[model samples]
Target: MSLVKKFATVASGTLMSRVLGFTREMLMAAALGTGPVADAFYAAFQFPNTFRRLFAEGAFNTAFVPLFAKEIEAGGIDGARRFSEEVFGVLFSVLIALTIVMELAMPLLVRTIIAPGFAGDPQKYGLTVALATIMFPYLMCMSLAAMMAGMLNSLRRYFAAAIAPVFLNVILIAVLGHAWYKGADGLSVGYAMAWGVMAAGVVQLAIVWIAARHAGISIGFKRPRLTPNVKRLLWLALPAAITGGITQINTLIGTAIASTQASAVSSLALADRVYQLPLGVVGIAVAIVLLPELSRALKAGNLVEAASLQNRSVEFTLFLTLPAAAALLAISEPIVRLLYERGEFAASGATSTVSAILAIFGLGLPAFVLIKAFTPGYFAREDTKTPMVFAAISVAVNIATALMLFPRMGAPGIAVASAIAGWVNALMLLAVLVRRGHWGHDAPLMRRIPRLVLSSALMGGALYGGAIWLAPWLASSAPVLSQATALALLCGAGALLYFVLAFATGGTDIAMIRRNIRRGQAAAASMEE
Candidate 1:
């Protein structure tokens, strides 16, 4: 399949999941507001999710995909299957042990790492710990799911892995909706959501397992063995684990810094959810699909194809991310108010808090997407150490900046620190890639980047101006009409400006894009047949 088609499959599924996630958050905001219950739930969710990203998405997949691809290439199907089973057995045992440990230590983990929002409120502090304890086991299920996802991606079967997350959002929303309709207390709803998280992991794991089975990959728990294959997998996974830890440390720093603020840390998380929708849909979808493909290509000595795929992924990321960052910055307040300003959450402070964080995060969207796009180059070649070094530097910068800024700017300071860290990480990765000649300033990139930048600038200016024009309407008493008008005008203006500038300046190759669209449609049709 064409790169665009692959990206589209991943992107479409991700976009669906994100939209549902947004709906889920909206309901939570309306049902519980930014209160102790909301704070507890978000913190609880973050605990498992942080580790899920660190271990499963970041570490396991990074290590597993390349090695699995190598085995498939070298030893064919049988070898790949055996290697995967061995790795799975080890991974299963380790995750089970880790989950047991985390469950026991959940209180301490919540007290230290996830405690910022709950410091002043003893009840919230205690409840967050309890909720986190209940949810910590989610990491084990999702980690195993990630391993299954890796197996699927190695086989170039991206749909099930890409779509598994949708179940998570759907189940959470269902649970939250049920609680809200039943008019359950905030605490009750929060627990329901937490339990929903665990349940969703089960569903996700099942879907991926079935998909892997259909793809002719069998995964089972055999007697744990220290086989050479298992050792090799461990060797590759260690650097990935460290790299993932560095990345997670960046978030931990932000959480710690934001904790120092009062009454708004949870709101910052809400804003993050808004921005994460686009980042997750566009950035992560592309990364997941591209990484395994790049790894296989590099393993087969197809440097040119790998390079081309890398370039396209970068371009595609920029194309989607630039305007999204601008739009979020432009419409942060209205979007937050429109979606979240209801029931107990409909407070001026809540709107301001979410808006501030969204705007700050907007500054880093491009950098965040680039990090996803660029790091795969190293991982594709089984070189996690380079990215790990850069990640350590980025985390240090993040910590320093957050400490310095939080004293003055409060929660916004943490957001600024994260943005700075993102840029630092992206630049460092790019520099290393260039120095090693792993990535280069190809003609397409050189020609398109300036145009892409220009288009983004145009979109930003248009959105900013449009936002001002729509501010009176947005701030008016009629919430529905004002929000509708504000969102439509701002988005429409930004979209028009970006596409026009892109087409006018040759920022997009029309023929190439058209061919990709056609290819994606054909691929979908073939799958249906």
Candidate 2:
């Protein structure tokens, strides 16, 4: 029932999904490699997935959850339930129409938006259109699923919504594994995975819908109506749909720029998968849980509690984010090579490019997570326009940087641009929060942050040396097992070293962390009642 317990539940589910997703990407690398086929498939998938992230995770949730939470506070479950149903009906009808239209115009969508880079290659362009058409319906399914997720999160039930993403990875892994074992052709593999994407959507939607019903929130469809609350939600969601997702939108932009160069999109996609592991597990966990908690606190006029939770979320965010950033910055090459350098995946160009991209994104991991932790402060107050303005600035920065650097640095330059833009966005958000007096800069968080930075620096330095020491072994022509062992040892040693030094140097309190986890366990028991 407490914040810590809620975070644990969400974090666990997200972690599972991320692990599965990582495996899915690894398999995808072996099957498709960094080629036109891989490029086409990722572009096709990214089209629908972009909307999923933008609507489901970004704009819609920020708008929906706080309003839903307030309705519940105003008149309990009955009040929020009706509001949700109205919104759901409208959302469902709109998405259905949108899907039908988009499906009809798949060719244009592919040409203008998804992958203009493939236009010269008729085969690549045609396949991309086919794949995008097959997967476009996923947006409808996930948008509805996202609505359900927002409803569930407002009720403090996170497990189902958090775990629903795993179904997509599970389905993809199964399909890809089957295809690979059969040695299917590139188009056959892509065809199988594309259909799997749509199927996974249906499964994910069913999952959260069933969970919502089981939790006693009867959200069902009706004739679309523009009720006052639904209209308000639309008003809030419109700009959010555009501006709430600077990161995803920027990635899409970066990918679009990268697509102009053959196979560059796939390379960037692989790098994205690596950075997303930490982002999904830590950043998303904080944002998803923090938003509703902050909304509830402010709704009840508990400013002190709101401030405390915000501060703590930031503290906890940095505690994990700093080390994650370090890990990526330190071991990106070995990590990329270890996971993705096998089979058709060429270590020379693809893995090296991916490592560079990973390291670049790593430079901004802390800023990205900080944005996640801080933006909720605005969303909880229904002040999205400020974040939207800042998002626009960040997007501009990314575009300009990418344009300036892409010619010089290639695909990795887009990633570096994204990282630089992320820092700009974070600083802007924090400055605005402080200006509005919504931020809480407590001593514990302040003191721990510097220490966390120092400790992360220590880990980065150590990992750099270890990486050199193990480079020859990892790069050896020995058996896969030897490389695997060296990779594991390098990672294990780096993690162990970081934790020991961080704790010993008073960067993080082992006792406090243990107590928090224990409290989460105890509070979880009480939730069953």
Candidate 3:
């Protein structure tokens, strides 16, 4: 398969998961609103997710996939299996200990790192501790799953790992639906959501485990030991884990600061969910696929191919994210209102707040995606230390900016801080990569980026006007069908116009995309052989 095809496989799965995630969020908004339970629950939920990203998605995958791919290249599937089992044994043991420790220390963690602002409120603090403890074990399941996912991705089996997240949303949505049907209170819904998260983790892990088994790797238990490969992985993983932790620290800081304000935590989360759709679909797809591909190229001493891969990945990222950012900025208010301004989420206040945050996040969308494209340039070459330094700097900037703005601008201020930090990290990564002569924009990327920007700008203007024209139908008092239709039309028209403009302005060429696809497929075929 070509790069585009691989991207599609991952993106399609991500798109489904994101859409279901939106549905789950919508139900949460209806059932819990931006109330205390919602705040408590979101804060609690973020605890395990923070660790999952830090350990599994960020640290583990970054270090594991490249090494796993090398193992396959050098010693074949049997070699890879031995390496995986070794890592898994150690990983499993570590996770079990971590979970036990976290469960016991839940209250202290809630009051300190998780959501210090909740400390004053006895009910919120207690509830956050309880919920976090229930969900913390999810970290173990997802961590093991990440190990399996690394195996799958190295084998060019992207769909199972990419699609696994949908179960989380699916399970949560069902929980919310059941609770809503029973007219459960916000507290009841929150508890149900926590349990649902735990169950989803198990389900997701099972899915990937089965997929890996089918792929000819059935990881089994072994006593933990630091084999040479396991030790090397741990060595590489330490800096990567720190880098990932720094990124999450930015989020933790935002949450802690936002927790001081009423409804700010939930509002920021809702806004995050909106922007995450594009980020997950485009950025994550690029990150997951690019790392292994680049590693293979570099490992084979194919410098030119590695450079092309990075440039095209960056191009592909901008091509998709630019228009997404445009749409988010264009219709943020209407989008938020249509999606969440029902039940506990009031149009009068929460919608505007969330919309503003969403728009701010949009401004940073491309930068966020670019980070995904750029990091593989470093990680593929086994240079985790550089990115870790950059991540620390970015976190510092985020902390300083968020602290400076939160007192004045509140939740949106945190979003602004995040966007600024994203740009800082992305620019630093790109600068260093260019300086090291590790990546550069080729002719197509150079020529097409300007056109993509122009196309997105034009689309943004059209979307803005369309949103205004459809205001009546998009209003809070409008029929749900009318609102849905209006939103869909605006999105459809914006997308159509963007593509048309992209083609007309020579921003994106049909012929070039086809060539890249062919090149990607040819590359994949050669790797397989």
Candidate 4:
């Protein structure tokens, strides 16, 4: 498939998942709000999820896909199947063991990691431990799911993997809604949500398993073996795991700092959920789809194509991410109020927390996207260690900044620390890439980046002005309609301003974009034929 078509397939599925995810979060906010129950739940949720990203999605995918792709290229489909089987066996063993350990250690882990949040409140602490224990095994299920997703990605079947996340949101929404109807505490909803997470992992695994079967690359477990292929995978996975762990250390730091704050640290997590919607849809989708393709291109000595693809993906990421960052920064209060100010959640608290964190996180949105775009360069080369080193530095910076800033800035300080660390990570990656000559600014990038910056600045300015002008109306009586109208107008005006500036400053290559879209459509049609 053409790159654009491949991107579209992944992007469309991701967009769908993100939309459902938004609905899920909205329901969660209404049902749970920003209370102690929500705090405990979000904290509990982050534990399994943090590790899942580290082991399954981040490290495993990076290490597994390139090797799987290589096996296919070198020895055809059968060899790749054997390789996958061996790797799966090893991965399954490790994850199962890890999950068991985590389940057993749940209380201790929560005590150490988020002690402050739980220290003053015994009930909250107990609930967090209990929920975390139930959710800990989700790491195993999702790790298996990731293995399945890697297989599908290796076969260039992007749809199933991308769509799997939607099921997760659906299940959570259903559980939360059911719990709400029963008048269960939000903590009950949280436990339900935890089980929903495990259930979603199973469904996701099944979806990708079916896709792999359809592609004639399915495998089942056999007697465990540490074959040479398995050994090689483990070796590759070690550095990848370390790299993923380092990246997540920043998040761990942020969580730790947020825990030390007041009763609503997890509400910051709720606001983060809002910003992560766009980040996950655009940044992660591009990263997952682009990585294996880049790996294959590099392995096949197609450097030019790899470079072109990287450039295009970066352009696409910046084009979308900048506008999203602007919108979040400008309209965070209204967005938060609209989505979360009902049921048990107070409008004032939600507005304050959301506005603060949104502004802080918006500062780093482009850098986050850039990190995703640039890391593929190293992963494609199977040099995960380099990124690990930089990631460690970024983590240290993140932790220190959070420690220093949190006393002064509270929950928002943690967000700022994370964002600044992202910038640090991005800069380090870019510097190394330039030094190695793996990624240098091409004429197009050199010409377009300034324009992109200018366009984003214009959009941010317009959004700020628009938000101020509409603030009174948004804060007035008839809040729902007035707030919605204000948000829509501000977003519309900002979008128009961005487009106008982009077009005038040559930030957008309209002709190229249309040509790429047409080519993608033609490719899809030919595949159907």
lDDT of 3 at 510: 88
| Residue pairs that clash (backbone atoms under 3 angstroms), model 2 | none
Candidate 4: misplaced stretches above 4 Å? 114-116, 242-247, 515-529
What are the models' TM-scores?
Answer: 0.94, 0.96, 0.98, 0.94
List the RMSD of every prediction in angstroms: 2.7, 2.1, 1.2, 2.3
lDDT of 3 by residue, 1-529 (tens): 9988999999999999999999999989987889999999989998899889888988767899999999998999999998888898899989989999999999998888888888989999999999999999999999999889989998999999999999999999999999989998888999999999999999999999999999999777878999989988988897777664554667777998898887899999999999999999998899899999999889889999898888888889998999999999999999998889888887336888899999999999998889888888888899999998999899889999999999999999999999999899989988999898897658878888999999999999999999889899999889888999999989998999999999999888889898998898787788669
Q: Report the CA-based lDDT of candidate 4 relative to the real structure.
A: 0.79
Best by TM-score: 3
User: In model 1, which regions exceed 4 Å deviation?
Assistant: 116-120, 242-248, 514-529
**Mind giving the per-residue lDDT tens digits that candidate 1 earns over 133-184?**
8888888888888988988887878889888999988998899778877989
lDDT of 4 by residue, 1-529 (tens): 6776777788888888878877887787777777777778878888888888888888767888888888988998999998888878777887788888878887888888854557667888898898888778778888888888888888888898888888988888888778878988766788888888888878887888888889898797866799987777777776676565554566666776677554446667777777777777787778888888789778878788687778888888888888888777766777777767776676435668667887778888888888888888998898888888888888888888988888888888888888998999899988998899898567887788789888888788778777777778667354777777877787787888898888899998789788767765664476459
**Alpha-carbon shift of residue 478 in model 2 (angstroms):** 3.3
Candidate 2 residue-wise lDDT, 96-137, digit = tens: 898999999989988887887788889999999999999999
- What lDDT would each prediction earn against the true structure? 0.81, 0.87, 0.90, 0.79
Model 2 bad stretches (over 4 Å): 511-529
Model 1's TM-score against the true structure: 0.94
